[model samples]
Target: MDLANYKNAYLTFALSIQQTRVVSMAAGGALESFPKNLPRAHKDYVVDASAKMSEKLKPVMKGVSGSSFEMEFDLDDGNPYLLPLVGILFTHVAGLGGSPNVDYGGLLKAQEVVMLFAHLEAFLADSIRVICLKEPRVLKKNKKMQWDTILECGSWEGVIDKMVDEYVFEAGWGSIKDKIRNMRSAYGLEIGVSDTVLNALDAAEQLRNVLVHNGGRVSREYLERTGRNDVRVGDMVPLDGSYIEKLSATVTVLGGDVFSAIAVKFFGARPDELRLVFKGAGTVLE
Candidate 1:
């Protein structure tokens, strides 16, 4: 009855519902506007690629945690699912072939980066559900709820938020999800990752790039009247500290989600085993 009973958990549930709706709407819109003039191959490829990638990544990409570790992503797979990442990248490259500032090189790279993060985010969320359900924390924190309850004290929302926060602090993907979420919302759709997820993904991606690419860093001097250099960059930036923090965060977030979803969907063994499968959302709550 109290508003506090809902709070953060309710917000997260609402956001999840909203995001699902937005994705559905976006897909519907895209389908509606499909040019009749386009070749059948284009549509076939999109459907085939999305389905294959979704299936392939669904199994292995679980619990990515948005980490910056290159080794974490170094899978040698000939799965058909991976074609979409390459396909999406090629589209942008072809479209923006001219001009240096907004040209093919930068645009293609950006497309890959965006697609990679999108795939990573979904994988992380799915992983959290799997891990948490399979290996849940003993529910000592809230004695009111039964230990057997899948989501203790109805605290799945808090669990998700905590995981996301940890992932953000650790990964460092540069708030790209936030930017994309905001952009989508502005256009009247509510698609987004949580702020916690966004932060972790950004940090992870950024730190990973710095480590793998041997990218150079330059210090730009902003002169005040007194000309005192604040937060100056030293000779060589140690990538170790930043990357470890990000990877740790990623683990927690993805792990938590896997736990929660599994608890919700598969707690107490398969629904048939517990005779609770029919007690789904279709039933009215007392």
Candidate 2:
């Protein structure tokens, strides 16, 4: 079931949060200053220094988020899930590198969070297949496994492995949303926390598509997809560190709860992974 790997993914992501905080504080300073009272210097030299710092910070945040993201998505190599959550941290890093206006880099980082969420959804979809789809004991003339079962589970065990793999590769499934809905419905799985998580992901997707495919320029497609009609085309997304942290926390809780619910439902009990200290998520040293 690779359940251990899934739990570890969240742990890895949670620990990465500390790295983000550390890197960000180092870049922006530790004092709590309100923007309203902060210095409003418009000098070119001051701006240059911010950008220069960003360049230095970008790599550290990227490395942290990227490794965590990989922990989830790198299924075959067992590295980690597709980590995504260091962008808002990087804007300042990019600033330190001397390009004071680091919003462009921030936009790019926000876009990465979107991609990471999408990949995580796919990972969950694959995991659900193990619980929702089961192989029939013997071949009957009238009985054939459902399409999703074949597609989701390609030869985890016996003779059908090769056949199932070919079918999954060839067939088409809709979005990750479609797959999640179907799996839950088929198995009557309880996903009390998924709705909130999905909302965050949906928002991420809307922003992601724009930042990734449209040069950070808002468009009609983005407005329609996100249902954010207050702005017009070419408007850059407003992403910040706090918002990114909110998204990360939402996804983290969702994964933990959803995994627990599905595991208990499918196996009639939680796996031994319940012993793993899930405590490390969102914790950091001062």
Candidate 3:
């Protein structure tokens, strides 16, 4: 892969997430004053519409009394006025009846961390696939396939693609150490990341797993994988903005490291040349 491709992809992901965070913060601030910011006419319309909707729903509510089904509203109720009314209701609901003690910012940050690692995993798998495509001999026949499946591919390129997908799927994207070892063993390619970067990546993977599978609570597996002793299992992992920002920066560095290694090893690119290319593309390599 070209260094610029990797740089652009990662930068785009990071920038898009940062913009989302900014927009979310702005929306939260706007929502605080959403009711007050409406015109008098709009306010009156919202009040009248809400009362009318409540009356309309009263019959349905009585019909479903003591049942498990919750009330649902169609936001696109064909009335344009309902949109602003929905926004007003959302403000109160999200604020938990005006107290507003919910940690929405933390929740967003946690989700961002999960998404960042997911992107990294996808990029890593793509890198492996690209390398196997470029050098087909590097793909070991470790998977068994039926003759029908092989024939179904129809072409050599299709077969190779199937083999690549199988390899990536079986190899999985769990342990960073196992990933590095697999890359070196299967493709004779060394990832060449520092211990610090490897540890960060490992910790990131662990955090992603906990956030996804354990409701962001620390697990024994997380501690074992990340080598973290700071928090015990069952504790909620703190995903503050600064911590997520630092993790994002580390992930970006890890991306560059992996991309540079792959480019040099498989694409016949020199490190110095790749650095210059990335710099020309506005990514400073250290």
Instruction: Please report how far candidate 1 places residue 122 from its true position, in Å.
Output: 8.8
Cα lDDT over the full model 3: 0.65
Q: Which stretches of candidate 1 lie over 4 Å from their true place?
A: 1-122, 125-197, 214-235, 240-246, 258-286
Q: Write the per-residue lDDT of candidate 2 for residues 123-197, one digit (tens) a residue.
A: 464454444234322222353567677666655563355444433433225544455565567557676555544
Tens digits of per-residue lDDT for model 1, 1-286: 1222222333344344335434533443444434222346656654555465455545444545453222122125544334545455335434644321322222323333333444445444333333333334512233333454535535776654454444434333334455445334432333323566555555555533432343322123211211324423432223232333334334333333332333344343333332321112221101
TM-score per candidate, in order? 0.22, 0.53, 0.67
Deviation from native of the Cα of residue 190 in model 2, angstroms: 0.8
Cα lDDT, all candidates: 0.38, 0.51, 0.65
Candidate 2 clashes: the total is 38
Candidate 3 stretches greater than 4 Å from native: 1-75, 78-100, 224-232, 271-273, 276-286
Report the lDDT of model 2 for residue 45: 33
**Predicted model with the maximum TM-score:** 3
Q: Rank the candidates by TM-score, best first.
A: 3, 2, 1
Query: Mind giving the per-residue lDDT tens digits that candidate 3 earns over 1-286?
Result: 4555655654564465456556645544543454445567766666666775676557755774345433466666555667655565556544446632445556677777777676667767767766766777777666588999989999987888889888777666557557876777777775655666566667777788899999999999888877878899999998756666666666655565666677778777765655532212222112
| TM-score attained by model 3 | 0.67
Clashes of 3: 0
Which parts of model 2 are misplaced by more than 4 Å? 2-108, 132-159, 162-176, 194-197, 271-286
- Candidate 2 residue-wise lDDT at 32: 29
